[model samples]
Target: MRVVMFGYQTWGHRTLQALLDSEHEVVLVVTHPRSDHAYEKIWSDSVADLAEKHGVPVLLRNRPGGVELLGALRDAEPDIIVANNWRTWLPSEIFDLPPHGTLNIHDSLLPTYAGFSPLIWALINGEPEVGVTAHRMDAELDMGDVLLQRSVAVGPHDTATDLFHRTVDLIGPLVTESLDLIASGRAVWTPQDRSRSSFFHKRALEDSRIDWTWPAEDLERFVRAQSDPYPNAFTHHRGERIRILSAAVSEGRYGGTPGRIFIREGEGIVIVTGAGARSGRLPGLVIKRVRTEDGTEHAATDYFRTMGGYLTPRP
Candidate 1:
């Protein structure tokens, strides 16, 4: 099959590599230009770079519009269009151009987590499992019919980055199987249940702010969701910004204001959390590690030298 791929970043790079390794022919590749933003994560194995290495023509466009793009697709005459982590809206002119139609590889199970940072959102929401879904492309975002779905268990200690690596590994197999089904004319299409669907907007630095009012478990998940490669969940302390690297739910029950910093024996600096929805006992979270605005990383004990203050949203 002649595939015209639309993708960007690591997800795109991996998918393109899988397709190239397969019997399918990737005639044309469309990817976004390298972003200069310091916070944004540029792909280590970029789709554009991979395409060039394979001697496939590449187009760097955020939006797949204009006559040049349309003409390129027409000239290539793609049998099917495969998109993975493509950031822009693709008009029907391109998606509907191919004979086998377009297929998209999404990071989450369809009918849920349908937008940006799906793995992060799922982890923050405390989902038991995270999965990837291969589905038919439609005008609506991620509201397509399902072709293939695979899930990975989200362990209690699994961070968003951990889940991300696991999820990406599934993409290649999912894409290959989906394409095989499509080529064999045995592809099954399952319509998504709109009632069960949920969409999330793109995340920003502001979204990573740690809200102390949340339950201890939720806050712990928040920290894990944004750790390392992504922005760490943060809070303000005495006009200083502290990025929470990792945390865990403490076993003790403390009756105090939420977000108040307290030391626990062998547990590090523990912050009181909100009362459980049903348990009524106040929960707490043990801070494992943090990074201060001054760019110093510290263990909780060293960071909160004398901790008796509350962590507030404002300095």
Candidate 2:
């Protein structure tokens, strides 16, 4: 079967690689242009670069709309259109162009997490599991009929970056199997239940700010969710931005105030959380690693020499 693919970033690169390795013909590939943003991580093997390496036609477009794109697709005459991690809205002119229709590989199980940074949101929200969904493309975002879906456990210590790598591995298998089913004319479509659906907006830097008022467990998850390549969960110390790279829910706690630096020991820096005493024990978060604005990484003990102040939001 001939395929026209639309994708971007690492997720896009993986999907395109899978299609190229499969028994399908990828006639055209559409990818987003290179981003100059400092925060964005550029893939070494981008979709456009991969497509070029494989000798497949490539289009660099943020939005896969307008006449030129349509004309190119019409010429390619693909059997199906496959999209993975494509950010923009694809008009019906493109999604409806192929004979077998368009199939999208979404990071989360459809109808549940229907928006950006789903893996991060799932981890931050303390979900027990995370998965990917291959579905037929529709006008609504991630509301398509499910074709293939697989789930993986979200371990207690798992970060968003960890979940991302795990989820990316599933994409290749799901896409290959979904395409096989479609090619064999045995694909099953399951309509998504609207009642179970929830959509989330794109997360910004503001969303990564650590709120000490939250429960210690929740704050721990928040730290893990945004660690590493993502903007770390951060708070202000004397107007200096300190990004929390790793943290854990401490065993015992005594509450003076939420966000106060209560204990500074060799183990870690324990900050009291808003979850007050329960059964004579208060909740606290033990921050193990941190990074400052100057890009200096440090252990919690070294980072906090004087431990009486609080971790507060910038005013």
Candidate 3:
């Protein structure tokens, strides 16, 4: 079948690969145009690059729903339109032109995690399960008829960056299967239950701050959620901001006030937390690694020893 593709970021890159690997004929690609020098870094791989490699026509548009975009798709006359990680709203004119309408691949289960940063928000809220869903595109953001979904377990050690890589890995095969089913006319479209829908906000640099008022386990989850590549849970010590690289929730007691340094053992430093965030348990975290404002990473205990000032502060 002749296909028109629209996608952006890593997810879109995977979708294009899936379509190229499958039996469908991708006639053209619609992607965001290059921006000013300052904004360019935020944009990932260009769809035009992939199109050129595959000998497919590429359309660079800041918005995908405009009249010019509609005219382009109409002229190409693709049988199916597949959207993935695209930033713009897909207008009805383009959707109606394709005999199969349009199918979109969302990075979460329908009616849940329905916005950008779905996985990051899931990690922040301490959710154990996250997944990818392919759905029939509609006007609403991620509100559409579901075509397929696959769940991934979020381990205690899992972070937003980890889940993102795993999700990207699944897109190649998952999208191919969903497209095949739709092409064969066996696509099962299930409407999402809007009653159960929830959305999340984007993760800002400030969102990485660790709130000591939250319990130990809650702090632990927060630490793991943003760890490594994305960002790290952070706290203030001796008036300096320190990023918590890794931490383990302890079962024992730490009676000190939240943010107080309870003990220093080997490479670890036990930091106190509140009772509520712990889900009714002990209140603190054992941080293995931390960062100083000087940009140097240190074993939590070492930083405590080297710095003369108070390592722990009262909340």
Best by lDDT: 1
Model 3 / residue 251 / CA error / Å: 3.3
Q: Model 2 clash tally?
A: 0
TM-score of each: 0.96, 0.95, 0.88
Candidates 1 and 3 compared by TM-score, better number: 1
Report how far off residue 242 is in candidate 1 (Å): 0.7
Better of 1 and 2 by lDDT: 1
Ranking by TM-score: 1, 2, 3
Candidate 1, residue 302: how far the Cα is off, in Å: 1.0
Model 3 ranges off by over 4 Å: 33-45, 275-281, 306-315
- Clash pairs, candidate 1, are none
List model 2 lDDT by residue over 1-315, tens digit each.
999999988889999999999999999999988876423463335889899998999999978767898999999999999999898888888888899889999999888999888898899899999999999998998898999899999999899888988998998999999999999989989999999998988777789888887888899999999867887899998889999998988887667778888786447999888646333366689999989999999999888887798889773
Query: Residue 171, candidate 3: how far off, in angstroms?
Result: 0.7
- Indicate the TM-score of model 1: 0.96
lDDT of 3 by residue, 1-315 (tens): 999999876688789988998999999899876654222334266677988899998988878656777888889999989988777667777766799988888888778998777887788778878889988887787888898998889887887778888877888888899988988889888989999999766567677787777777777888877766666677778677788888887656666456667676445777767844334346457888887778899977777764223333221
Tens-place lDDT per residue, model 1, 1-315, is 999999988999989999999999999999988876433473346899899999999999978889999999999999999999998878888888999989999999888999888998999999999999999998998998999999999999999888989999998999899999999999989999999999998888789888887988899999999868787899988888899997888877766777788766464788888744234386688898899987789988887889798887778
